[model samples]
Target: MDCILCGKCLEVCPLLRATGREELGPRAKADLSALLRGDAVALDAEDVARLAGLCLGCRRCREKCPQGVDVPALVAGLRAEHPDFRAWLWKTWLKRARELWPSSGMAAKLIPEKFQPERLAPFLKALSLLRGGPHVRPFVAVEALPDLRGETVLLFSGCTARYVRKEWRRAAEKLLEAMNAGLHKDKFECCGMGLESAGFGPDAARMREKNIRAWRRAGKPRVVTLCVSCHKGLADYADGFEDAAEAGEWAEALTPISALLLDGRYMLTENAPARVGYHRPCHATGNDLDHALLASVLGERLPTPDGRECCGFGGIMQLGAPELCSQVNERCWQSLAGSETVITGCSACAAQLTATAPEGVRVGHWLEMFDL
Candidate 1:
């Protein structure tokens, strides 16, 4: 194990920094995961749950690890020892039903009045997240492109946009129509993000296989997605669990909407320039092209992303360790407090920002700005 135990992860871990607990840092927790999974450490269910709860699943530490280990996956293996309470109900039972509501009007019932955070639940507070809420970005159609043969791209409406952020689906549709490409969707299941995060490996694997079959049936169309997590996850599946970036075209096709539009796949309507600040999601570090493209689009309106930190929506961390979540969120919240409308490319960050935002301030997906 070339871990070195040098403790660099402690320096960068948002959760560790917020909580000041060494055991919660990536290195220590990852070691714990190794031990628990190896059965070298005899831990009861509560002990295992306690260990897993400290991880936010941000993978920020993995981004910095010298050994290149995937601590989240390791933690997931350990989490399987003692899953969270009602993991089946929230991750499967209800979440599955919600995914089916993407195209339905039933989403409207969850909207908050005046787009106020206090009026909405943590799950539906972002702009047009519920799409039932006011301020859904109106679709601005692009000039229709010539119908080039075999130019179709399938839309992978991840659960974030499918169930909660209805505008994400609508906004993606407008771009597809503008590109004049063959846009299609099939009966796809969850990207298995929730299941994997919840430590249900077999269930997650099943969902991944189901999605692979759906994509194949959709004629293996290149996939374009609005969610970065989905883009990464789909790529992971295509690679057969290898590094997604090395997985070739199936992974490459999982492009973000902004990058595709900037590459001229779809022409965006004119921007009604407003002074909106941008926050770089923690994962944005991996997508440089998108960072540059977004900055280019917001040229004069965009400001420096100084003091921008993690929003602390680290998967299960919100439910497991909220005080730590708040501690981590406060720094990012302070950075975004000035903008009346703060734009970010991450759905999880958008949700966290919306929950913590003061009255009259709106946190919206960056895609929303392009009639986003």
Candidate 2:
């Protein structure tokens, strides 16, 4: 399917503003891909690869497209077709240092001290430098919760929440306790977002199967996650399952933590002191959830006017496009300018905003704000 050449996507894209490159815009990119697929002149491998790399995979384009073109998927397909280009450009040049020397832990350790003016200019280097915290070894066994409550909820904390932004797990646990729910901790694969983004379809599908098996073994309670990437994967599962007439029979149900908190059954403290601005994750907002449940929970504490803006941390966008990410984040930061703190349900948004936020403005998760 072609992009249909609708310019709606350009209106809401943050990357366009940061790069000032019209060719990088969704419609242009989509048109280019379609042209290449047709009888148009074959693009040089480098140009084709660069075009794929330019996307942040924010899903904003998906949201605005009337034809509902999955631009990210298209980009991934292009990348898969040219693995050599992908490895050389993205893995070797951009991500090799972190994946090779010093490790994510060492990178995180050096961030507070070494990240400065010189290193911060180029986006990829800055991302590698801002490791935030240690690299969490995925699927490590933690102390399991005491007992299973009425319904089981498997908590998939993804890579970032497991290692980099560990605070989100604590806040989520507290909120779950307040709601009298049980959490099942198990070793699960990364949601395969990186693989999907890199066009490793078989690898991504394998990881998805692993996640499905793990959930099945865990009694398939409701699955709640802290990362938007994880939630998107789970939502994809729900869609695929339902499409195959296998609905409601999965190992566990999956939903965002914010959705659980919005059930209205949990008791909330009256007259909370903090004033918060909510940063909408592109996955959640772009999926059209609008995060109304989180907004309701925040109530009078919510920021006014533009509560649905992105904090520019979608997928691996910040890593690949740091300047653009920072530029986009500035708009999100401005929306919360008057507030004492900004709250987000997504860990990536929390981390990106926390690292680059203007001094004195605090960043936190929505559950972290509650006095649970």
Candidate 3:
């Protein structure tokens, strides 16, 4: 696919819409990609670094691109050429999540508000969200689970649930156990989405290979993911498998926890606020089973004017241009005008939204809405 210089990508880009920077748009990035690939023009190290971190990696531009140009992939290619601190830090965070993730909240709390500069707000806010409060309440209670007694499943609880939000993992386990689905215990690492977006291609590839091996050792049972980002990351791994049949099976084995709970019975509780909002993660590819499940239950309560707006958790972009990331997040919250409580499927989206939510607004994962 080639660039046609079409403005369609600009219209859907959350960053371009938020900051009004035409140079940061997909058309500009696509043009730069061609130059970078051909080495047609001399680009300084600063220019390479700037262009590399300009994208949000939401892939919204790809949807609007007439020539089918993948701007994020192009940006990733640019980033791969220049190894930087942002990539190193993101790689370390994902790779050493167990050792470093749990203490991040404490690290954030230690920094006083007065000392926190405006440029670091995006990163600080994310850490603060991890240092949660007691206000988050469940809106639904699991009354019954499906009878999949003879089956076994593996749960791919992402880094956030594994280290920060243990409740999500516990809820998923109870639901799986209630159905009598044998839970396979496996030590799964980061999904590699963060590393791939940050331009650490080799590291991400290694992580993917490690995860695929873990799946194989588990007898290739049905894998359930709680995070939308994790599901997309693992689903994309089907490309890594050499065998066509095994690749197809890998794709089929990956499932979202919400999809598995579509038929389970739940009792709506009074804990649900009067006006709740659902923030759809950008990685949600198709019908958005998470949104579908929430819509079936919340109905009139969940009235989001534009729920699909990108929350601006732009992977490694947060480390490079935190202010721009915060600006995009502000635009996302503006779309949900009257939402007192906001829920999302992706852990990153939940953290970003919670960080940038209005004074009285609250944000949580869709799983947190249920008491399993």
Candidate 4:
């Protein structure tokens, strides 16, 4: 009810701005949520479910809203109340994608796409290739250090890192081991970002419970992840378990590799001097930990380009609305206009940017700057 209805969210919304779909904007979703909460219902359960599927979950809507309305959560409720086929499919098969393709994204093929087989094949192949690319890799893998310092920390190997780009997991491990900290590896499931996006709150909760229990079983030491989405999901769950208002403030609390460095827990003695640019991801926000930590680790080697827009890997949006995803992602690639290598912090961004990167332009993670 606090929404000033200033329409600020519409102006910068990647989906609305790119596709000009006013109905997909936050205001419309909020209105729909209100209707679901009461009477005078215009949309039936099916129509309501369609509207819920039409979001990027980028939180730009809430970020830009003056009222700071929890539109995403509201839409999530509507989605939970209405179980559509697509939601059901995502709730069911997305887990398969995570588990079966532990080293690839072959599961994205399940999404109903509008493209011909030839065109779609290459995109799926490109997604599968997200796990490859030493040319675009930011950090090199180092052997585990022998010395140990602090107690073990839980390293949540997100699906993308586990399957698509194992280097991300390797990088996280290498970096952590350098800090003299032992690792607590578990048979953890997906962090529930995809399930949450699909409105499968119960499914998402189960995954969250598994992770929470993993933490409990592992002694609940400090936790960290290389994947931004996983980090966001885990942190949000922890915060929600504490307070509603703090729920989804995950980026603010989730410990990225950057935070460890800032805390004197990890140290980068030197950096390779390279003329490289960067792609700022949505999940890398909060206290500018990514930017500051990169500067400290990379030194004068970093020359990131301007603009920090979404790479169009908004979980299900890429699968259900590829065209809109492409348009928004085109903007991100464009931002890398004059750079040699584009570095980012999120696995999804790395994958999307790498898939569509221009000739001679490589996309990588910020951790790649380390010599290790």
Top candidate on TM-score is 3
Ranking by lDDT: 3, 4, 1, 2
lDDT of 2 at 288: 26
Question: After superposing candidate 3, which stretches have Cα over 4 Å from the reference?
Answer: 105-117, 133-135
Model 1: per-residue lDDT, tens digit, 1-372? 446787767777878777788878888887786676568558888888867867777767777788877777778777776775534333543255464444433433443354443322343333233343323242233333334345888888777677667677887787677667688865777777757866787877888877777776776677777776666666557424334443464665566766666654233355443556677776665655555666665566666775337887766655556667778888777776666667777667776776776676666776675542
TM-score of model 1 vs. true structure: 0.81
Models, CA RMSD each: 5.6, 6.6, 2.7, 4.4
Clashes of 1: 3
Instruction: Report model 3's TM-score to 2 decimal places.
Output: 0.93
Clashes per candidate, residues 3 or more apart or on different chains: 3, 3, 0, 7
Instruction: Tell me how far the alpha carbon of residue 124 in candidate 3 is from the true structure, in angstroms, after superposition.
Output: 2.2
Count backbone overlaps in model 4.
Answer: 7
TM-score, every prediction: 0.81, 0.77, 0.93, 0.82
- In candidate 2, which residue pairs clash? 220-251, 220-252, 223-253
Residues 233-256 of candidate 2: C-alpha lDDT, one tens digit per residue: 656653324234345555236667
lDDT of each: 0.65, 0.61, 0.81, 0.67
Q: Model 3: how large is the Cα RMSD against the reference?
A: 2.7
The most accurate candidate by lDDT is 3
Name the runs in model 1 displaced over 4 angstroms.
34-42, 93-150, 238-247, 263-274, 306-308
